[model samples]
Target: MLKMELFGESLKQIGCFQFSGVPCSYLAPMINYAINTNSFIMSNNEGDAVAIASGISLANYKKSFGVVLMQNSGLSNALSPLTSLNYTFEIPILGFVSLRGERDDMGNNTDEPQHELLGIITDKLLRTCDIAYDFLDSDFNEAEQQLQVAYDYLAKGKSYFFIVKNNTFEKCALNHDKNIFFEKKINTLQVKDSNSNFLPKRIEVLQHLSYFSKMNEIALFATTGKTGRELYEVEDLDNQLYMVGSMGCVSSLALGVTLQTSKKVIAIDGDSALLMRLGALSTNAYYASLHNKGNFCHILLDNESHDSTGGQFNLSPNVNFAEVAYFCGYEKVFIISSFEELEQALCFFKNRNTGGAILIYVKILKGSKEKLGRPKVTPKQVASRMANFLSKD
Candidate 1:
């Protein structure tokens, strides 16, 4: 039997302890072990895991390799960030992928019809993503050899993968009954008095954020599309991180940043963007409650349309964001549809978030200024700047 603790210890010895992933039956015991005894995060999905890993790795730059573990069936989910975010930015991650239906000695020939095709093409997919891979063995010595290969690739600013057979990790059962606790708190949400013209456009909100960030020691993470472009226009301060491509991941990235920094981390998001990664709302809320130091804030701009994507309809007209944040466990929820409300909410969270995590819903107009430009810098540049800023404090 492979000792899960030994492998985890080896990973720590080499300074690669940040682990994030979804659970798979093949690696349940290992995941359980991680939950019990490591700085592990239950990333909402495979791709979220990749992004969170990237954030953690970037936070611990020069001293960490973010490890992502998932099943072969979910590799497709991870392909986006693995290629665009991690590979493009030269972020390294050691992946442990379960071979759900391999044809070799560890093959599950009769496992499931769905796992068969995914297993057959797992290595092909990895190769297509320009990721190098090696199969994992039960022996710790063999695993260390594979880790050495991954470490070598990481040293050169690249990613690597490990394909593992089922049952490679010994059983580590979850005692969820004793380890779990849930408490639902009922609190009324507050709204500020503000003007509701929706005239200034989302750009105005970005401008407000720019001014606010300049005055306060804050870290700002913008969502993809116009929100990012508009923030770029406002001014790309070292503290401002514009998420260019990942639509719904801004909050997740901000959450990861909050875990590493004491700065007031805020995710400036859009309506469509928030809808795309609704799970992030819950994830951030959960973590904020656990780490309830008021280190995180979520500012969502609801224009009622996907203005960045040709103004497509995003969500129902009646969706109450304040209620969503309230139920999601935000320490304070503000439903601000006007400039006054927006300003007041900003002031409330400015000096200190005495209440807890905050969500500010800013309803704005649909159109932006003519000839709005994109980020002049590359993603790696933006990521590196943000990473460097976060590392300092």
Candidate 2:
């Protein structure tokens, strides 16, 4: 069996870093190794993990593979990116899945009843993804060979999988000495008043972002639903990555991109999406502080409701996202209610020289253009173009 460090070192040899996944007991040892000595993120869900991996791979320019790990039960959650992302863009990922309910000699289920149906279909599901898989077990040479095969597939622009039965890796303990989140000066919001009737619309906000994104060469990652659609309607830029279907992973995707590029990464997020994956905020905060490059922005276009999926309400009215981001280690917090304040905030971001993260809380009204449209390009095209742009800049 491979020790945790050996496994991690082997992965480094293949040019892979930036691990993102949900916590599963079968993955704890390997994850602990990452937590202690490597780049790791505890993502909000399996789908978010996949999107983060996708972001890393898109920014990698065929040089590295990002790893995403999750339990087999979470396969359904990950399917969104597994299909729409890797399959669509030919972006490769070293995905690890925990096979929870593998039956033994007596044929009794090894895990809870909830896993039985999924366990039966796990391999078939991988087959459906057209992804090749190998079991991770007690042989170092054999497992390394399997990884080599996975690398071969990745070189050809495809994802590969590792299935762990139960208890595969040696324990890698988390050392408390490491600072997961670096200390930064506590941030406070400077509020300015605006006319309630003159509050800007969503499309107007997206237009401002689009212009700035192109002007500043900032990589823009928009949340799924109307946010992406509206951004597309405003203008399609090579630097933009539109979230197709992953609802809650906009910031996670932004984090991965921020890690790989010096250009500022801006996530145009929605209230519902943010609420779904609140953990991603802390993940972004921790990594943003560690990878402080003076260029990361998080904009919450909160309409106080799920404006995309009909006027369904979310918790943003009761929850203060600007305050939340401030506590989450964002260096600059801007909670404003008008276009003038937003302009001030963007100017603040443009002029800041050192490490900084900003959250713009604009009290926006709900409405969109009558003829909203999606991005005309494919996800692969979008990713490749962004990769090329990032490489050049």
Candidate 3:
């Protein structure tokens, strides 16, 4: 068995500090160490972990890095962002995925029934994702060599994985609380005039929000579909990234970027996309509450329909997004239906420097401009420029 310190000290030696992901038994020792050192962000799920880690990688490149941990079963949850976000953007992250079900000498599965299929196919899945991997070594020098190889891959902007077998690390006790909690005075605002029949269109809100991209103090992220396309049409700036895929990961990516840099991150998300990864709301609030240097603003454009894919109705009309965010631990919540209220919310974000997660639920109308064109730049180009902008001191 390998002492956790042998691996942990090597990671620190290579300038990797940020860690995020869900818990896995095989990774508990490392997770406990990360939590004890106050360097880990507990993610809601595997996909969010990948997106969050990608954000950290993008913010500063090789100078800093993030490691994502998960069980092999969680690979299904992580597949989306691993392929769409990380692969498309060419972002690198080191990961530990535990092997729960492995065949013995007689070729018999040794884990529960649920892990059977995934374990049998884990190697193939990683290969399909274009991720290279190596089995973690138990010896000190061998483990250090493996980590250096992983770091070499990361330095070239390529992701690498360690397939952790059972009992890879010696047992380590957790001295810190695993539960995430933050007690702060949260501000709630309901900005519906009740008499005004005016509801902002998607473009109108995007136009107003594009002003933030004009300045470098804020890093703007537009969600997939019409939201990103509309923002691209308004203006593509060095401070903004138009998310092409990974439908619901924009907010989690924003959280990752927020944690890495002092620049405030604003995620302009759609109702459908937000609903796809609802658990991220709590994760954002939880991390923001603890990491006081980072500020994350989540703006949900509730148009009640999927304007990009089709005019199908979504669940947003039935959901109270602002109240849900408040209950989920957002430091501030704003429910607005008119442009005036949106203006007020923007001012609130601009003037306040208090670090925590903030939510703005804006009611918007559907439909886009005639023949709205897609972004001219590729996703890699967009990610590269944003990374450059964030890296500037």
Writing each residue's lDDT as its tens digit, candidate 3 over 1-393 gives: 888766788998876777999999989998988887788888989999989988888897777678899999999899999998888988889999999888888878999989988878888899999999988987878999999999999988889999999998998889855555647646665654547566778888888888855753678999998788889899888888999789899999988998888777899999999899999998998888788653678998887998898779988878888878888888888877667878887777877666678898877778887799999999989988999888874
lDDT of 2 by residue, 1-393 (tens): 567788887777776766889988988877888788667877768887887887788788678978998999998889877887678767788888999988878877889999888878898999988988888865777777777888888877789999887768877677878756546855676543444555678889989989987998888988889988889888888889887767787887788777888777889899898898787777777667777676778898888898888878888878878778878777777876667777888887777666756777777887777877777898878878888888876
The order of the candidates by lDDT, greatest first, is 3, 2, 1
Top candidate, metric lDDT: 3
lDDT of each: 0.78, 0.81, 0.85
Q: Could you give candidate 1's per-residue lDDT for residues 209-292 as a string of tens digits?
A: 888887886888888888888899988798887776666777877776677667788889888877776777666777676665
Query: What is the lDDT, from 0 to 100, of the residue 370 in candidate 1?
Result: 86
Off by over 4 Å in 3: 177-180, 189-196
As a TM-score, model 2 comes out at: 0.91
- Candidate 1: where are CA atoms >4 Å away? 104-108, 184-186, 191-199, 316-318, 353-356
**Candidate number of the best TM-score:** 3
* Global lDDT of model 1: 0.78
